[model samples]
Target: MDFDTIRNHYGILIVLSTFISRIIFNGFCWSYGTVIVQLKKQHLNISDTELSLIGSIGQSFGGLLAPLILFLARRYGYQLTFICSLLTCVISLFISSLIHNLHWLLITYSLPYGFANAAIFILGTLICGHYYPVNQHIKHISIMCIISTGFPIGYHIMSAWVFSSIEKNEWQIMKRHLAFIELIATCILGPIFTMKYSSNIPLEYQRPSITVTQNNNNRKSRFSLPIIVWLIGIFTTMSAVNNFLLHLESYLKYLGFASARADLWFRLHGLFDALFRLSIPLFIHLYPVNIIYLFPTCVFTGFIFLLLVFGLLYTSINALAILPIVLFSFTSAVTTSLQYTVSNQLFDKDETEQGYIYHVIITSLGLILGPIIGGSFLDLTGNYKSIMLISLMFLLISFISFSLTILLSNKKEDTHQSEQN
Candidate 1:
């Protein structure tokens, strides 16, 4: 193929490679849930709490390492960062298969693998920045949303398929397969991603505009009001979702819903979440939204439906509660799925990597704090409604933060336009 033809298709190739990377990352990360079932059945002696530590530790370390991951990626460049991290993930998974002991597996299997996932994931965003010029990054968000859906796809579908029909005694085999799948996927995309970073690129390929470069020079402007507010918005949004999902089944049981019915909606939430993420490019195509405003609009809409669901629960109108739940699920899905895109718009094109790194770091807090706060409220008040209230509280805060982001982002845009004129 000619250079222009390869250049023309390079963006799609990058999206596809990143998409596959996301699938492998989440597929392996969440495989622990399925792995736990077999583990519990086999060990019989291990407490659920102890078994739970495996996934939790992995996720915690995975998320907490974002800053360091950024440091390395920036220092070593994407080519080395992606390859080394991918290898680390594959090797960790392979080593995990050899150890049957839960304690060692906690350290051996999940921790390094999770860190590698974070490195690959963070670097993926940075590398994609190279392909799409800074001005066009907003458009990049569309494909990125398509890519983001890979998480749910992995969580809901890939993990199950990996374990499907495997004997209870064969989980070691499952880990090996997970390693192989990731390794193979990396190999397939290695050439494409290799061309994406570090070597053959022009020096002036991705320099930021003078205005944005000026803004970046000031650390305070880098963390300007709008961006800080958006950070707050993301934190609350994630906390609310995690808080709600962590206890949804229990809350339904407390409200007298059948176990089977609750399971259906709970699973439906994930299914619908993925579907909505898939629909994002179409939604953008039809609506032509300015993501600056759309981001807040979505969070607000979701907050409204979520509140309606809570109201239905309190009014003894539980029959219609699931309706709002489904609607909330849609908005929740869109907001979370488009978050990375929205974050891209929050900063100058050249500064997006730092913005994204901060975005991931803040999100990890929501993940940890959400469940803890929800569980605490439930335990303290002996009321499941308390959990709902906490979720609502965070959701509302997220909406407000996003709205403020809209106002501040617009103000910054207006200022820049005025200065140019």
Candidate 2:
């Protein structure tokens, strides 16, 4: 009947909390394409690459600061860490709304906002599985899958709803809108996470942030052949994917689609992505975390890239464009969802943390590089099709990287078995 009673059975709250954080993070990060277009109009003199850095710079900082985030979470509990980070996020967004200068926006908006979103999303999702019993395989996996779906779902919500509601020149209002979202999330979710551990949550959920002490003997080197190839695959794939996500709105405009239609297509693309991610519950039930399966996901993504490239080759690009966009979003969602679990399968039990940290770094590097490269290319050629071609190449490289990972990991296993024999 009371708040404590509600806190005791907080599984739904955890889901909602993590889900909303995902929306804010993914929506803002991925939908920066909308943000960049607005900024470009206001600052006609500023280069695209420079404006792109507003989002890219934040991602790089977030990835680079993963260790610090870990330390903070451990030292101060996930609840406190999330609260502080989101608070900073609220402040950052508010301050950024007032700033018109590009440099100041980069410093105020991107850096702290990126850092805060990373902290909240990482810490929030990290404890997600803790809510379910270890024996509840489906429950655990399904919860995570459901939570992860929030990313693209938010992407669509932001692109379609927020952009369509605000005029193109209303960049200032957009930042405040985002800040208010963060504020509401902070106010609501912060207290929910701050609840006592003895509530109806699982035993593993007793402490939001368990101390992972230094164990040099337990530290697995991430430089293994499989990991290197794995990182390479991820790096290349995200470089293309993030670039596409960041610039799709602009690219659609370039393709002769009206702004409303562009927003509609953009939202639909992300909707397809979110809808496809719903399969993760069934997927985890059938195959679990089979790293080998990721190879096909990458190949499919690359295949979609090829289709997208082919789609752009004609003047009647619009006639055939929607199909590839739908397919691309679907395949991309599958690949992106599996990325975290794949790292767990690739590394030893102890190495998941290290591998994940490395994973975040590599992913951030890709996100950072994507906008810069994509922006420069777009600036030079004034074409979005070229972006597709380059993205296709990146996907191809990722496919090859994943191939090497599978082959080398298998070969290493065989060699070890032969020696034992």
CA lDDT of every candidate: 0.69, 0.71
- What ranges in model 1 sit over 4 Å off? 30-57, 94-106, 137-139, 162-176, 196-217, 246-267, 307-326, 376-386, 409-421
Model 2 stretches with alpha carbons more than 4 Å out: 1-9, 132-137, 194-220, 284-289, 309-313
Give one digit per residue, the lDDT tens place, for model 1 in 8-94: 587778778887877777545644554665676689776544554565445445667787876666566666778888888889989
The most accurate candidate by TM-score is: 2
Task: For model 1, state the Cα shift of residue 398 in Å.
Answer: 0.8
Per-residue error (Å), model 2, residue 28: 2.4
Superposed Cα deviation of residue 346, candidate 1 (Å): 2.6
Backbone clash tally (model 1): 0
